[model samples]
Target: MLTRAQVDENDTVLITGASGGAESAAIQLAKARGARVLAVAGESKHESELDAGAQEVPIRGCPLQDQLGDNGVDVVIDLAGGPNWPELLNV
Candidate 1:
């Protein structure tokens, strides 16, 4: 997924469902590639996500745009697809 997204050192990647196994792996990979990672998951999982190399773990329920302000990510890896999926596109 990272390859397809052309993630690179300059990119800021936003990853949803960041507490899951795949998402955790994604976070590490994105970080290893030198891209900054922002994870979105439950508050309970924030520490683990941060440990996995996410620079910031935003609160899951909060609007991604609000947390990120005008500095939107360069790549969005959306692993959680549901009602909020469309919101990711906007961000």
Candidate 2:
């Protein structure tokens, strides 16, 4: 997934469903590659995501676009593709 996204140094990568097993590994990989990792998960899993190497975790109940602001992430790994999938593109 990182290869397909062309993740690189200084890039900002966002991972949805970030508490999953694969997503946890993805966070570490993104960080190891020198990219900043932003995780999207429930509040309960925020700490775990951080422990997995994510630099930031969006607050639950807030829109992703609002939290990300104008300068959004360079890559998005959407592990939880569902009703909110379309919203990811906006961010």
Candidate 3:
């Protein structure tokens, strides 16, 4: 995500699919850098923030898209930027 998003202190990263290891690590580092980390994932994966140090935002259906609006995200760490990504991007 840094390669593209260029994460900064004021950036807020909304990490979809928070259960992955690499993305989880990235969220942790982003938060440590003083960025607000909103870890979005399925209800079952909400407990992961204990180690990632991110504020868990459970998406019963589509939480990231729900939180995101017309403007672009400061940084989006999409674990699976496949077909479902458009839903979040449209936000």
Candidate 4:
């Protein structure tokens, strides 16, 4: 999907649950392809995601909607999908 979407150095990618298998791979691949990778994962998994080449968007004590402002991310790779599904649709 990343390739189909033409994700490149100019893109900002948001990968949720990035510590998991699929998301983790997506993060690494997207980064390798030159996109700016922003990841959302458990507080404990932040370091791992960083190691995989993504910037963490702390989701623990912080409000997610606030962290993600009006201008949304260019691409979203969601592995742990939930209510955030609808939110992503809106974005």
Candidate 5:
């Protein structure tokens, strides 16, 4: 969708719920592909959620919303899929 949406390489991407499951998979995949991915969540410290030397782990918590104005993410992948979903949009 990013390619079709015309998102560029410098664009920041916000991915919610980074602590587990499929969302974690997507985080790793997106980072591997070279996107600057921000893993948004209340907390993230699971076993595989972050590898030993992952370049940048997503910035966690609602406080990160402050970045909305300037850090401005280009795309958002809300994997939490519910109430947490709105944080990505409303932020």
Candidate 6:
């Protein structure tokens, strides 16, 4: 999906709910493909998400929203599929 979305080197990719196995695998895959991946999850799961090859972004207080500004994201691998869904649209 990342490749289909044209996620290349230096492109930003966001994958919500990184605590799960599928999400973690997606994070690793995105990283291996050279995309800068942001794994969104709870603060407690940040370390595990990072270990899966993604930069951490807490769902509660997502700094990425401000960091990405109006440019938004190149691609999103949404595993959470909840309220955070709309929020991920901006980053």
lDDT of 2 by residue, 1-91 (tens): 8888778897999888898898899899999889988999889998998899998999655799988888787888888888887788777
Which pairs of residues collide in model 2? none
Worst 10 residues of 3 by lDDT: 63-72
lDDT string for model 4 (1-91, tens) is 8988899999888887777788888998998889988888777887888888886555643555677776577888777777677665554
Best by lDDT, which number?
1
Instruction: Point out where model 2 deviates above 4 Å.
Output: none
lDDT (Cα) of model 5: 0.61
Q: Write the per-residue lDDT of candidate 1 for residues 12-75, one digit (tens) a residue.
A: 9999989889999999999999999999999999899999999999999998889989988888
- Checking candidate 4 for backbone clashes, the offending pairs are none
- The number of residue pairs in model 6 that clash at the backbone is 0
Q: List the residue pairs that clash in candidate 1.
A: none
At residue 60, give the lDDT of candidate 6: 48
- TM-scores of the candidates are 0.95, 0.91, 0.74, 0.84, 0.64, 0.81
Off by over 4 Å in 3: 68-72
Provide C-alpha RMSD values for all models, in order. Answer: 0.8, 1.2, 2.6, 1.9, 3.4, 2.3
Say what the RMSD of model 1 is. 0.8
Q: Flag regions of model 6 displaced more than 4 Å.
A: 61-64, 67-71
RMSD of 6: 2.3
Q: What Cα-based lDDT does every candidate model obtain? A: 0.91, 0.87, 0.68, 0.78, 0.61, 0.77
Instruction: Show the colliding residue pairs in model 3.
Output: none
- Displacement of residue 1 (Cα, Å) in model 2 is 1.5
**TM-score-best of 3 and 4:** 4
RMSD in angstroms between candidate 4 and the native structure over all alpha carbons: 1.9
Q: Write the per-residue lDDT of candidate 3 for residues 44-79, one digit (tens) a residue.
A: 777775467776464737644555544345776777
- Once model 1 is optimally superposed onto the true structure by TM-score, how far is the C-alpha of residue 25 displaced, in angstroms? 0.3
Instruction: For residue 80, give model 3's deviation from the true position in Å.
Output: 2.2
